[model samples]
Structures are given as C-alpha cells and as structure tokens.
Target: MTTYHFVGIKGTGMSPLAQILHDMNYNVQGSDIKQHIFTQQALEERNIAISSFDKENIKADQVIIAGNAFPDEHKEIVRAKELGLPIYRYHHFLGEFVKKFTSVAVTGSHGKTSTTGLLAHVLEAANPTSYLIGDGSGKGMENSEYFVFEACEYRRHFLSYEPSYAIMTNVDFDHPDYFKDVNDVFDAFQSMALQVQKGIIACGDDPYLHQMQAKVPMLFYGMNDNNDFQAGNIQVSPEGTTFDVFVRNSFYETFSIPGFGKHNVLNALAVIALCHYEQVEVSIIQQQLKSFKGVKRRFSEKVVGRQVLIDDYAHHPTEIKATIESAKQKYPDKEVVAIFQPHTFTRTQTFLNEFADSLSQADAVYLCDIFGSARENAGDLRIENLQERIQNSHIISEDTIDCLTGHGNSVLLFMGAGDIQKYQKAYESQLAS
Candidate 1:
C-alpha cells in the first residue's frame, strides 16, 4: 500500500484528516514548518512521521495530498511532480474518499464545526461512525456505518463534495477574500444544494437559504412554527439551555444542551432533525447533547483567579456577536470583555464597521493587530481603524495584556481565527507571577 503524505499537515482541517487515515491503519506521514502547533499532538500520539519540509520527504511510493494554503511552487509539491507521484488537493481527495460511507456534509458560513461535532458524537451512540471535525478531531471506526464531516464553502470547495445529506446552518457573507458579496456566496451554496443525493436539512430562518432552489427536499429547522422542525418553550440557566422540539407544530420531545446562545440551540435542532430522520432514538440524541464537551476554541472556558477566560474562533462579525451573547447569558452578573484579533486584511477591511458594531456589544473591548497569513499581502487598513469606530475600545498588545486583569472578574472572550492564544498565554503568565 502507498503511504499517504500530507503537505502542511498542521492545518486545521488537514490535521484531522491525517488522524482519520492513521486510525484506519494506513501508512500516514507528512511534513510542515518546524514551529509547533496544538494540532500536532493528535498526529504525534498516533506515531505518524512528521518532518520539516524537504525534497527527501517525497518518495516514489508516496501519494501526496497538498493543503489548500500551499501552492504548487512549494518544495515538496515540486518534488512530488518531478517524481511523477500521484497528487491530490485536499478537497478533491476528501470528495472521493467520503463516497465510501453514508456521508453527511455539514456546510454553512458559521456553526459548521459545532454542528458537525454534535452530529458525530450523537451518531456514534447509534452506529459505527467516522467523523472529521474542524476543531482538529477525527476518528475512523472499523466497519463504519456513517461518515460525517465538516464541509466549508471557501472558494466553492464544498461543491466538490456530493454527500447524501447536507445541514446548512445559515448562509451569510463570510470569507470576503474570495466571495465578492453575499449574493456570490449564496450562488455557491445554491450549486452545492443541488448536488445532494438526499434531502437537505437547513435553517429556515435565513432569508438567503429560504430563497435557495434545489431538486432535493429542503427540510427547515428553527425557532418559528413555520419550520418543519422547530424549537419552542426555551429556557436558559447557568447550567445550560433547554427547549421543546416541535415536529410540524407538535411537540416531539424536550432536549437540553450544556451550552448557551440561540445559535447553539439551532445547531442542536439541526442535529436532532437529521438523526430523527435516520431513526436514531430521541433519548440518545438528548444524552449526547447534554454531555457534549464542545469543540476546541469554541467558547472553551476556564477560571483564572476571578476572571473567566474563554478561547473562541470568532473571526467574522456575526460570530463575534453570538460569542458575546453567549458569554452574557452564562455570566449575567459579570462584564463581557472582548479581545478580538482580526484574521486577514481583506476580511478586516470588508467588515470594519460590522466588526465595530458587534464588538461594541461587549461591556469592554480590546483590539489586537491584524494577522496576515501566507496566502495574502498587507492591505491599507490598520487595527486602529477598527478601534476608532468603537467608543473607548483599547488597543492591546502582548506587552499590555496585564490591562485585562483590571476588569475585575469579567468574562474575557479571546476571539479570533489567528494566533490570539499568545495574548491569552501572556496574560496567564502574568497571573502566575
């Protein structure tokens, strides 16, 4: 058997895919930068060979799967081409690989990762399930009955996948780098919806998704009675949130999740709807939702002294808004302090005002410098541009992280897609001192 080699193996999606293949007893190994990443722990636990990029890493017996972030000009990719080895882009390979099992593709502008993780956990109790979560989690079970994976809409890569069913949480304009506008993003999702072999489970509340046309049945789930699957009689407390599930205006059952926010309730609704259709018992779904530990860096929390520190991946404006709301719900007595690090120049420029409005929802706000990835160059915008829009928002750096301690037991939400953890790390070190 040919060994599967991954380029840029430490990436968010790439790490989990490598882990899944390794679990299946495949010869999995890869290369990346010498710098350490949190995702590398999973790969190393499996004893997968991970070395720094070099021409020697490529051999005639290897099958290369190039990460989306890397280009053909990279040394490893160049070496693979010279040797005439089989090469596959990450998305292309995943599209073909998922066909082997009963697949459910979780797609949307947001909530894909959380919803995907929820589905995998719930389904595993009912069937032998394999999953690829965006939070760097994946497992390949022997004789797996289903394959559930997170499918992203960046650059229309999700269209490459043809899953049996799809759960589109919502369709909002994100990834401003590639998509020109909301309509452009909708067009891509519309194309993806048509390709589903089975029915589609979608959030009916989204106006863009409501306008979508597809040959497959569009099953809607939301808080409103108009939806095929609805959540009503909601209750939220410090423990978590509970709501009644109404199937076509009649109560099916009541469920609780160990999480706050309406967005989370909707995520559970999508999972409940899909599993109900598949004949999974309501008791199993309820149990899994209640016990879900949640995905990494998504409202993940810990208590440090008096302050509540949370790490979340809320790069987009809408996601930032939801994160703040959840924080407020969980700790109504404390302040929600947002420490936001913008991911890319294009996204920051495109959603500058929108970002300001969302961050202003918090009791206090701190802004970090924009993180530029290898894919794009610096734009004309600066971090101060966003700071000026929000009244009294402080510009923070790793050196000034101590200022956060002054908030007096506030819920500090460290939100970003980039390396905002370093700021949290800096604060933790100061607290230790």
Candidate 2:
C-alpha cells in the first residue's frame, strides 16, 4: 500500500484533503504543530495519526504533500527532498487527483466553501460523490461519479485545476498581500476560466465576473434578468431564504435554503444551474438544498442564554457586510454586535476604510488586534485606525467581556479568517465562569 504523508495537516484545506485521501483507502498520516484546531477533530475521528512536525516522519517510500503555508526550507520538506520522495503542493496534487472523476471546482472570493458544500450535498443524493470543502470537511467514495471541491483564488493557486465544470460565485478584491488590485485578481480568474472543460456557471452580478471570457460555454446565474439562470421573487425570514429560479425567463423551480443573506441565495442558484445543466433531477436538488446545514464557520450559530453567537469566516469587507446583513435578517429586533479581528496586515492596510464602512452596519462593534502573518511586516497599521471610523465601536480585550455581557437579547457575531476564535473562546469561558 502506498503511504501518504502531509506536512501542516491541521490547516483548513490540508485537513480536508487528508480526510478525502484516508477515506479513499489510502494509508495516510500527517505532521503539524500540536496547537489544537477545529479541523483536527475530523482527522482524529478517522484515527489518522497526527504528530508534531519532525523530519523523522518522512520516509523514502511515501509521497509527501506540503501545505502552501510551509516554505521549501521547512525541516520535513528538507528531509523529503533528501530522500527524493515524490513531493507535491496541496493544490497541485488536488489538480491532478481531480482528473479521476467528473470534477466541479467552485471558485470565488467568497462563498466557495458554502457553494461547494451545497453542490456536493445535492449531487451525493443523486449519485456517489466525493467532496472537499474549505471548512475542513471531506468525503470520498471509491466509485464516485462526481467530485465537488472549493477552489480558492488566493495567490492564483486555483489556476492549477482543470475541472470539468466550474462555478464562480463572484469576483471581489481580496488577498491584498498577493494581488495588486481587483484587475490583477480578475486576470487570475480569467486564466482559470479558460481551463474549464465543459462550462462555467458564474454570478452575473459581479462586474469583474461579468467581464469573464472563457473558451467553454459560460452560463450566468444571478438576480439579473439577463443571466442564463435568474433568481426572482426572493423571500428571506428567520427560518431561511426562498427564491424562484427562472431559466431564461421561464420558471424552472422554487428552491429554499436554510441560510440567510442574498449571497446564499446566489450560491444555491449556482448549484441549481450546474446540476440542472448536468441533467440531475430537480427533486434531488430541492431536497439537498433544504437539508444542507451549511459549512462550518460560515454563519455557524449557537444560543447562549438570551444572546445568539454567530461564528463566520468573513475576513473581507464584502463578506463582513453580508454576515452583518444575515444577522440583522435573522434577529431583526435584537442589537447586532460585530466582533471582528482583521486577518492580515496587508489586507487591513489595503481595505481599512472599506472595513470600517462595512463593520459600521452592526449596531455595535468590537475590534481586536490585527492577526499578523510571519511573512509580512506590520508597519504602522493598527486596529485603532478602523475604530475611529465607526460610530459605536471600541477595541476589544479581556476587559471587554463586561461590556459585551451588558448587551442582552443581542446577536454577537464573531467574524474573521484568522485566530479570532481564541477571542470568542475566551469570551465564552468568561461567561462560563
């Protein structure tokens, strides 16, 4: 049996890829920092051995998969190189592996995970399907006919994939550390669009995506009437959101998803458009959309006492605004409080004003220290700069628990793509004490 070893397996994308490999009956083991991460839970449940990073874990016979975050000088990577083991980066391996099945790569700035998860769920109901979500969830079947996965645009890594069909949710300016501007980001997506084998289902609402030119057939899905797949007569409630799908002005079907915000409605439309194009039964699509519980950390909610706490991976300004809007829709009568920890110094510096404008949508806001990356210099950017632009905003610390607890009957939204959960965990622990 071929053994597969992973470096930095606890990462959100790495963990899911490891799980998928394990489920496919491969002998898989990995090494990462001992720090606890939510992504490790599924790995542990599968009994896949995870150990602290060590060069001794590398074997000449095993293939090594390295996480993108790790440098070529990493100890395990050095050892693997010494042994001349077959080494592949995460995205490169996924790109090659996905060729085994009819793959659907869901790509965009936001909603990639949710859309991939939804499409996976819907397709699995009809046929054997393998899926990898960015939220650290994956499943594999030996005879899967369809493989659905999230394709991130960061650093142009998604350009590695050549999928059968592609669903692009939207194109937004994000990952400021790498790309120069929105046009730079669009060029990457345009390059990726050309690689799709069958067709592309894109959100027509985004001006950037609207300008996409693909060699394959490109189908547009959005609220706009000009789209190939249009969503109309939308209704949003605390329970969920429902919309009618129209295919080029003809009513197709009415679908509902157990999620809030117009973004989610657009996500489902992308899934519906692709599945319908593939000739999947409409009944299966409707049933799967109704049952999807949503991907982890994308509007994940829990009730503690009279307050609702939502944890979401909304690091970008556009995503932050959608999260705040979702909170308001679900709990219209309660105060919506946003607790955001800006992810990277470059991103924070680049979208400083935009972040302030979006975060101000909440009734109250708490800003935490910017989550710094080892690769970037912090310079002079500070959380204080963002707080100054918002009305009811304050810096959050261990001392802010008292102020947070004062907001009764409120929705507390913990939003970010960094280690913001530590702050949420700290607040939860204080409440317990």
Candidate 3:
C-alpha cells in the first residue's frame, strides 16, 4: 500500500484531505504540532497517527502532502525534497484524487462549506456520496457515485480543480492576503468557471458572478425572478427556514432546512437545484435538508444556563452580517452579543468599515486582539481602532470577562476564522465559575 504523509496535518483542509485519503485505503498518516485542534479528534477517530513535524518524520517511500498554510521550508517538507520522494500540494493531490468519482466542487467567497454540506447530505440520501468540507470534515463512501467538496478561492487554489460540475455560491472580495481587489477575486472565479468540465450552477444574486463568462452550460439560482432557479415565499423561524423552489417558471419543490438565515436558504436552494439537475428524488433531498444537523462552527449552538452561545466561522464582513442576521431570526426577543476576533491585519484593514457596520447589528459587541498571520507584521492597525468606529464595542480579554458576564438572556456569538475559541473557552469557564 502506498503511504501518504501530510505536513501540517492539523490544518483544516489538510486534515480533511488526509482523512479522505486514509478512507481510500491509502496508508495515510501525518505530523503537526501537538495542538488540540478540532481536526485532531477526526484524525484520532480514524486511527491516523500524528507526530511532531520533524525531519525524522519524512520517510523515503512515503508521498508527502504539503499543507498550503505551510511553506516549502517546513522541516518535513525540506526532508521530503532532500529524499526526492514524490510530493504534492494539498489542492493538487485533492484535485487528482476526486477525479475518479463524479465530483461537485462548491466554490465562492462565502457559504461554500454549508452549501457543500447540504449538497452532501442530499446526495447521500439519494445515493452514496463522498464529501470533503472546509469544517475539517471528510467522508469517503465505499462506492459513492457522487463526490461533493468545498472549493475555495484563496490564492486561486481552487483553480487546480476541474470538477465535473461546479457550484459558484457567489464571488466577493476576500483573502486580502491574496487577491488585490474584488475584480481580482472575480477574475479567479472566472478562470475556475472556464475550467468546469460539465455544468455550472451559479448564484444569480451576486453582482460579481453575474459578470463572469463560462464555457459550460450555466444554471443560475437565486431569489431573483430572472434566474433559472428561484426561491420564493421564504420563511425564517427559530426552528429553521422554508422556501419554495421554482425552476423555469414552475414550482419544482418546497424545501426546508434547519438553518437560520436567508444565506442558508440560498445554500439549500443551490443544493436543490443541483439535485434537480441530477434527477435526485425531491422527497429524499427534502428529508435530508430537514434532518441536517449542520457542520461544526457554522452557527453551532450550545446552551449554558439560559443563554445560548453560538460559535461561527464568520471572519469576513459579509459573513458576519449573515451570522448576526440569522441570530436575529432565531432569537428575536433575546439580546445578541458579538465577540469578534479579527482574523488578519490585511483582511481587517480591507474590510474595517464593513466589519464595524456588521457588528453594530448586534445588541452588544466585543473585540479581541487581532489574530495576525504568521507572515504578517503587527502594523499600526489595532482592534481598538475598530472599537472607535463601532460605538459600544469594547476590547475584551479574560481579565475583562466580568464586564460582560452574568448575561443570562444574551445570545453570545463567538465569531472569527482564527483561534477565537480560546476566548470562548475562557468566557465559558468564567460563566461556569
């Protein structure tokens, strides 16, 4: 059996891909700093060995899979080069791996994870389906006919994938570390659009995506009447969301998903559109959407005392706005509090005003120190500067947890793309104490 070793295996994408390869019967193992990441549990559950990232970990016969977050200078990466063993970048390996099955690559600036998850759930109900989600989740079926995966636009990494069918969730300016502007982001998506081998399912609501040109047959889905697939009579409640799906001026199906926002409703709509195209049973898709429990950290909820704590991976301004709006729909009577940890200096600077505007939607706002990228320097930009723009927002730490403590009715939302969980853990421990 060929062995695969992943460098920086704890990374979100790397870990899931590792699991996918392992389930494919490849002798898969990896190395990372012994951090207690959520991905670690998945690795442990699969019996994938995790070791320290050392030169010693690199073996002559093992193929090395390098995490994008890690540079070529990483010890194991260097060792792999010295040994001249075959190595593949995460996306390169992933792109090649999924080609064996009928693949659906869900790509966009936002909602890819949730959309992929929903699509996977639907496909699994209709037939065996394999999927890799951004939330560090992956499953490979013994004989899955369909493969559903989240395709990211960061660094144009998704360009490596030429999926049979591609779902464009909506393109927006994000990953300040890479793309220069919204147009630059759109250019990347357009490139990906041209690479789709079969068909394209795109969101009509996004202005940027509307500008794209694709060679494949494009099916547009959104709330707009002009789209090929439209969502109508949408209803949002604490329990979930329901909407009627219209295709080519006819009511195709009435669907409901146990997720809170219009964004989620849109995500469900995309899945339904794809299922219709695939001729998946509408009843099976509806049942799967209704029974979906959701992925980790995409508005995941935990109740402590009477207060509900929601954990979300909403780092960008648009995403934060969606999460807050979803919270409002779910708990209209409760005070919503947002605890945001800005992910990167470049991103924070790029969307500073938008971030302030989104957080202001909440009843209370708290900011943690900006989570700097290992590649970035701590510039003059500070979270306090963001607080200046956001009235009633305060910089918070474990030392100041008492200031916001004892809120039994407030919905505490922990939001970011970084290690914001540290702050959540501290606050939860304080509340427990």
Candidate 4:
C-alpha cells in the first residue's frame, strides 16, 4: 500500500480528508502547525501521527498533499519536490479522490457547509454515503455509492472539481483578495455550473445567477415563481423551521429542519431537490434533515446559567447577517449580543462598511482583534478602524473575559472564521471560575 503524507494536515478540509483516507485502510500520517486544533482530536482518535513540518518526514515512496493555507515554500513541500516525490495541491487531490464515487459538490458564498452536512446526513439514511464537510466531519464507507463534499468558490479553487451533481446555494461578491467584483464572482459560478456532469440545483432567488443560461438541466429552488423547486409557507419556531416544498408549481411535500433562518430553509430545499432527483424516498430525507443537530460552529449553541452562547463560523458580511438573523429567529425573546473577530486584513479593508452595516443588526456588538492569515496584509488596517464605523461597538480583548460574565439572559454569539474560539473559551472560563 502507498503511504500518504499531508503537509498542513489539521486544516478544516485537510483533517477530514486525512480521516477519510485513514479509514479506507490507507497508511496515512501528516503534520501541522495547529497541532492542538479541535480537528486534531479526530486524527488522534484514529491514531494518526502528526509531526511539526519537517523535510525529514518526506519519505521516498510517500505521496505529499499540501494544504492550501501553506505556500510552495513550505518545508515539506519544497523538500518533497527536490526529492522527486509526487506532490498534489489540496483541491487537486480532492478533485481526483471524489471522482471514483458519485460526487455531489455543494458550492456558494455562504451555507455550503450547512447544506453539505444536511445532504450527507439525509443521503446516508437511504444509501451508503461518504462525505467531507468544512466542519471537519468526514467518514468513509466500504461500499459507498455517493460522495458528498463542500465545494468552496474562494480564489476560484472550486473550478478544479467537476462534480457528478453540483448544488449552488447562492452567489455573491466575496474573496475580495482574488475577485474584482460581483460580476467576477458570478462568472466563476457560471463556469462551475457548466462543469457539472449530471445536473445542477441552484438557488433561483440570487438575481445574478438567475440570468446564467447553461447547457446542463438546471433545477432552481427557492421562494420564487421561477424556481422548479420552491419552498413556500415557511414558519420558524423554537423547534425548527417548517416549509412546504413545491415541484413544478405543485405541492410536493412538507419538510422541517432543526435549523433557523430563511437561508437554512432554502438549504433544506436544495437538499430535498437533490434527494428527489436521486430517487431517494422523501420520508427518509425528511427524518434525517429534521434530526440533524447541525454542523460544527454553524450556530452551535451552549448555555451557562441564564446566558445562551452561540459560536458560528461566519466571517463575511452576508454570513454574519445570516447567522445573527438565525439567532434572532430561534431565540426571539433574548438579546443577541455579537462578538466578531475580523478574519483577514484584505477582507476587513474591502468590506469595512458592509461589515459595520451587518454587525449593527445585533442588539449589542463587541469587536475583537483582527486575525491575520498567512496571505496578504494591507497597510495599517485595524479592528478599531472597523469598530469606528459601527454604533455602540466595543473593542474587546481576550484578557477581559469577565466583562461578558454578567450578560444576564443574553444570547452571546461569537462569530468569525478565525481564532474567535479563544474569546469563547475565555468567556466560558470566566463563567466557570
């Protein structure tokens, strides 16, 4: 058997792919800087060994898979190239690995993780299904007829995939580091839609995507008259959201999901549409979606005393707005307190006013330190810069978790794509003490 060594193995996608490969009885081992990340727990549980990045770890016969977060100058990757070992980019490897199975790629600016998780859960109920989700969830089956994976459109990386079935949740201007404008973002999705081998299920409500005419049979789903699958009469309760799905202007079935927001209702509709196309029984899909607890950190909730704390991986303006809207919908009576950590310098500078506008929807807002990635850093951009644009937004540091200690009966939401969990842990520790 060939050995596979992943160079930055504990990434959200890399960890899950490592787990999937390991479960398939492959000889797998890897390394990462974030060795103590929550995703690391999964690797340790499977007895997968990890070392700090080292040139010595690159053996002669092993395949090296590099994580996207790391650059070509990464120690192991550079050493592997010099040693004549076969190297693969993260997305390149995934594109190849998913082709053997009937692949379902879920792509969008937001909701890809949640929709992918829901679809994987629902499909697993009827047929053996394998999935790789951005939430660091992955599983392998000895006999899986289908593979469901989250396809991100950032940096136009998702173009590497040609899925058996592709689901476009919605398209919007994002990844300001790469794309120039909203039109640039739309062109990428249009390209993705054309790459699908089987069919495409897209959100019809996205005004930009509605105009794209494709060669594939595109089934539209949303609360719109033009959609082939429409979610109507939506109701959001404490239990979840319930809506009737219509196919071709006729009532098909009523579906309920244990999730909040109109965005989630549309996500459920996308899953329902795919299930119907795949010929899976509707009852099985309905029960699975309703029972799905949720993907990790996508509005994950915990309670301490009278305070409800929610942690979500919402970095962009659209995502932050959706997460807060969902929180308000689920816990209507509680005050929604938002603690946001801006992800990257480029993203923050690009969407400063947009971020300020979306964050203002919260009952109260707290801004944490900007989390800089390995990529670019535009000059002099700071959290205080974004904080100045919003009303009643306080600058918070991890050192003063006690400031949030007595948020009596408030819904404290920690939102970001970066290390915002540090703030959540600080708050929880303060409460514990």
Better of 1 and 3 by TM-score: 1
Span of ten consecutive residues with least summed lDDT in model 3: 401-410
lDDT of each structure?
0.94, 0.92, 0.89, 0.90
lDDT of 3 at 174: 91
- Report the C-alpha lDDT of model 2 over 311-387, residue by residue, as the tens digit: 99999999999999888888899999999999999999999999999998999999999999989999887889888
Worst 10-residue lDDT window for candidate 4 reads 400-409
**Residue 315 CA displacement from its true place in model 4, Å:** 0.7
TM-score of each: 0.99, 0.98, 0.98, 0.98
Poorly placed runs, candidate 1 (over 4 Å): none
Residues 50-145, candidate 3: write the lDDT tens digits: 998789988878999998888888888888999999999999998998888889999999999888888898898888888999899988876879
RMSD of each: 0.8, 1.0, 1.1, 1.2
User: Quick one: RMSD of model 3?
Assistant: 1.1
Residue 120 local lDDT, model 2: 93
